[model samples]
Target: MSLDSTLHEALTALNQGRYKTVLKVAKSGMKRYKSHPAFPNFAGIALSSQGKHRDAAGYFKKALGLDPTFHDARRNLAQALILLQQSDTALTLLNRLLEGAPKDPDGWYLKGQALLNCGQPRAAADAATRSLELNTRQPRALNLRGVARNMLGDEAEAIADFQTALTLNPNDVEALVNISLPLARQTRHAEALEAAERAVHLAPTHLNARLRLAMQLLESGDQDGARDQFQTILGQAPGHAQAIEQLAALNAAAANADLEPIARRALKTAPRQSSDAARLHFALARMARQAGEQEKFASHLTQANGALAHIMPFDSDGDSQQFESLRTRFNAGADQVQAPAPSGPTPIYVLGLPRSGTTLTETLLGAHPNVCPLGERAVPGVLLAPFLENDIAFDTAACAQFVARDQERLPALPDGIRFYIDKMPENYRLIGALLTAYPHARIVHMCRDPRDVALSMWQAHFSGKALSYTYDLAAMAHRFNLYAGLMAHWHSVFPGQILDVQYEDLVTDVDGQSRRLADHIGLKWVEDMAHPERSTGPVLTLSANQVRQPVHSRSVGSWKPYETMLTPFISGLDPNLWPGVQQG
Candidate 1:
């Protein structure tokens, strides 16, 4: 075929999603037109479509080298850079593109995405807004703006933007996926699940859509459905890293022995230093632990954490400073701030370190008929931002304003619902603000063995910018110490106001502990509270799988197996706070 005809065939194949055919055509065309940019560009597009981002980036660079003015090649290269987590490099290229074509909506949108990936949400929002102004109907721009807004802690605005994007392009899988996040945060799980299902239905073959659906199902307590979706994805693409990892997690949770071979195979082929490889290594670690391969488990766990750490280094000093400041400030006026009046519906704050029993506690409380669970809402953080930001004194005026703001953001509870649970574990840092706002509000401080909490956090994967401390063992221990100190201060100041529910105690005596919880929250002891597994509400936390199962002591002393690995964490922790763990 002629060179032009060959190029046309490759472009056609690319448009048709026939990546292999495009690769074949591009290879053939490159032989005839050795220096042509189009052939290499087409090859790059094909590779990128197949998720070979690094390989695609190399081809895009080759295309640009052949013809420096190839704008499309530059854009494609930027995309690959972003996918490869080189967001700074991607932003530099995107900025140059936007400078030449200031009104290019696609360029601005790409810039926004790069900025968002780099954790510059404000800049991302600005870029997305500029894109929207240039092309009002740009659905991707709207979705990007929504993501930025969500990251900026403006969930309502984010939801509106996502809805607008969906209206513009109903089949936009990203919009559907992005919309579910804010809904889930607001504890609107049914709506979130519906959005996830629709995204999956519209793009059954799309890996991200299918992954989102599986995750939603898992969080909604449908493990079987999640497993089926994951297995289906694996069947379609055996090397799908996320599917392999999630399936491994599911099997580990259920203690299924069948996933070991599959996980090993995937780990062998998984690329190093990528998020997928990190997750796969984590999965392998879990499976190794299950198989009684202690040394192998430790090796895989280290590899997994190291991979992610290389990608996103945690700011341990900044995190430590922030924790120290929060503890100091909260403790200083712990007894001075007078409690505000009871609001419309009493708020129940379930606060603790991440990977503690917060979700399980929330699920148990949510099983009560008059209680509603709002999974990890950011209302407390939002309400306290002004005070925290400006170092404003905690007073009745601030407390009243906070109460009003909180009530405004809270979703309408069902009739007869007396309490709404906000299960943001980080709210443990904001206990003083929370109690000052509404003293009548129930605060259940979920406590677990610090070592177990640290181990669990180190072992698991988390999305978003929060929980940076979890990336390092010493940081995790330091943060836990901060949490313990803050909790003690709150208990001393509020005396009997904060209910301390030890995870170990709760697991060993569910009925007894749950009855105490009910008494603390001023509710009648209900049998359902003891059986959180029977609760039908969605659990949007990492503990989703654990909460779906009946309460057990399996995790009570889970840190024992990893005692050697956790030596650094144990050493960093205060002996007074974590007594027995030091010797372990």
Candidate 2:
């Protein structure tokens, strides 16, 4: 008395607009298979129509378990699990089914849906693409693929897919909502808003469309528009955590109009966290150095250094080898250069490890009317390529010739843009070659607490930066010490050209330290040097957040709380670099 055939026929009928016969035949067939697998599933599907998800899920799961290879049972089980908000398990099962039918267009389409719910979009895009390759007419696959592609950062492909999905099915809310995000990513605010508004018009209660629109409005400085959108969401869900958290943070930020007073208070108070303590000590040290308080500056610098040394212990020998290995591949000696400096804006490179106030320094210098701080550039390394005698990294003659030919594509020397800042921290290694390229080009090497730098690197997420060494504390320590030893090498190689500005001094006395920097570059300063970010606009780096804000002395000695986690790294740290840390 199996009802498998009847239920299969009913789904076929249902999918083909035979609703009356589907319900009647499905009901009649259900009575015949009292306890059959298809009987329970068909019954569950009917029950789901009446909003009986709890009962439907039990039947679906039982049917799926009884017939493991049953495609309909598995598909229905996934749908049921989705209804119960168990998307992770549903996605896993759906993926398994998809793998079995790898070339099945419909299977790939369903797999994409499961992937979207699981927030595994990068994978979802591949599945969706497979679906389209098998059958280009799959509208659901097109729409889901568009969503997946958007998540994968392929904005152009995503827009086309979404448009095609709309052509196939004009009322596709998923396609409409998915299209707006890529537009936003492209910074096309008005177009994104227009698309999102159309989505809202089509589906008045669509939450995602409203949220995306709200974010764009907020970014465009339409605060009232953003407020209205957020308020509408809160009206539907009073305890929405994301909207609530954003609202709370926004309100809190509004309370503190300026960062200076808070930062000053933080500077006076003893830091509770290791990170906080490090920043304060560094700030105090910098201030002491600037006020010509030699002993106090030395003491504070020692303290700041000691605080950092505890986090990343040095590996002198290993780092020396690693540093040499990189140099053999990248460094350019003056002997490698045969031609004169390529005509262009005089390049000024600012080099240091992360969290060493590179941004602060660049902003201060870039604030001068004559200088343009491009933040970080691949061009310096590009320009220095021909001079670099790294036989291991390139076919030396070919690489040198390639640079000679394409050197003109570099930034045209704009009027008054005399000194260009290339503040890529790793450029410290390239200072030798850079000096070889343009003999008169200035270089600034920023010095900070090695341990603090490592600690900061661990706390931050640098997107896709390839310094895999930063994750391990001991590795970070080794890298920092290695970097320090290299700086020592640069000092001997290029005497009187490189200026070492300790970060601790800069924070303690911004005015005085800025003067030293100005003197090095032979430039006069303006009153705006007091707040570099406020004056040095056109930032194009991760430091944008820290630089957009005013000067703050809250980052020194910031690694103290994580001392326990940092101990492993500290043991290997260079004792000389952070004497205060070793003392602790």
Candidate 3:
């Protein structure tokens, strides 16, 4: 028999949960074909069975090098790296697989899973969407996409995706488990409870679902149920990280209403040397910032950064090429301004530098009974890219062609909800093409103090090439300036449609800014709009926790803490625009 055949038999046994058989077959295969691709594959299986995960990763890497098309080896390598607590490497490999084989649903699904692990929701959604394109019936791909959407701040759409996945395959444990994640994020205790129970029935050992149920119960102010669930999970898998962390958090939350205190307690008590500290600290800092405790928040943040910074190096493309290409394609002449009528639906884009309150703004507008929030979906830029001619010329025919194509896919909505909000913050770079396509769409560009916005962005890990300037501070300033110039050009091209709102102004005088925002879109001031901070829909963005609280200028001068480190990046930009940096 061929070496691959022997390796396949061993893999089949491993997939069938016969670890002993896997060991036996794998050992024989490894001894006979030590230098072949199947040799490494079998060796990886044998090492993994023996709990030697690092060694298994090495073997899988060798197997992949020997046979680049051995996707199974890459997948196995990624999982093994995860076991070794090397999530960044695993995610990078998964991303490579996704791009190399866009038609492979499994590759996309794996990339989505890795992205979810790393907390980059939009990229995960993009991968999942690609996976769906390849195999619409792929329940796992659909479920993963739903998870990504839910994380990116679209609760209703996420629910729809999960529901669709379940319709396709009734026994999808991950889908059942994830259904409750969005509910918890939205603070829907009752619905989350039902979903949690269903998940447990479908998968008796579904830790994440069980953890979600416990968290929902706790957050709903049900201590007894929360305690029981945590204890039950501990009984099955002692020292389970989720149970320990969530239980501690539950205990802390029960003691104080502010949540920051509880978060601090959890961080102190969490076991040292675990890779989860970064996320925990990130959660704490956001809550603390909300509670108006800058010092404590900064401390937790320092700790979190220390943990994640080691692994989460900015993974975005650093090239200025995509932006240049995009700009060159849609150099629509600025002299002609097409007068827009009150005919088609207005595209109200909530644009800003990422992490500078776009989600908060979207939620604020979405709370208005008249608007539908299409959270962070970069459809406008994605729409215009193909239609624009290569030399900055607008092709009206091509633009019209794409608009018709897109309008067909937009979900049907109820009456009185006329305006649609595309909250893609990075769309600030593409406001020019956006006007050419819609002509009638409203653009709300949200700006914060450059330092604060840059700092907020500095700490955050964005997934797109649009925010590629984020890794270096000077680069960020230059990009921000370019964006400013672009927005200026957009205003010159189509004046009166683009409205600028300083994020600082928005929070400082929310009622006043909101009124102006409402009037710009021609909507009357509604009392419910102010309650956007308390929006109960699943917010699927990094700001998911932040939007649930009232707006504040607490983040202003936020770069003060990192002033020393940011000096270079600050000096690199146009200093006059951002006044926070020390002048020479």
Q: How close is candidate 1 to the true structure, as a TM-score?
A: 0.85
> After superposing candidate 3, which stretches have Cα over 4 Å from the reference?
1-16, 24-54, 57-168, 177-197, 207-344, 385-394, 459-472, 531-534, 550-553, 557-562, 579-584
Candidate 1 backbone collisions, by pair = none
Q: Which lDDT tens digits does candidate 2 get at residues 1-584?
A: 34557767877876776655655675676567555567556656766666777777776776776677777777777777777667788888787777676677777777777777766676788878888899998778888888776555456677889889889888877777777766654535567778878887887677787776666566444556766776677567553433432332233343222322333455456443343444545544444434556566445444544544453334556556656865555343533444365566677788888778897898888887778776565444544444453434334454455445434433344587778777877888777566655667788889887767866665443422235456456667777777877887778666799999998889888998888888898788776776775752544344555666677777788766556657777888788865766666
- For residue 349, model 3's alpha carbon misses the true position, in angstroms, by 1.0
Give candidate 1 regions above 4 Å deviation.
1-77, 252-257, 333-342, 382-408
Q: Write the per-residue lDDT of candidate 3 for residues 429-467, one digit (tens) a residue.
A: 776666766776788988776767777765664443445
| Superposed model 2: Cα runs more than 4 Å off | 1-32, 42-58, 65-69, 78-103, 112-123, 137-140, 147-153, 166-173, 184-189, 193-205, 217-232, 253-548, 554-584
Candidates 2 and 3 compared by TM-score, better number = 3
User: In model 1, what is the error at residue 203, expressed in angstroms?
Assistant: 2.4
Give per-residue lDDT, candidate 1, residue 471. Answer: 71
- Checking candidate 3 for backbone clashes, the offending pairs are 151-540, 152-540, 153-540, 331-392
lDDT of each: 0.84, 0.66, 0.69
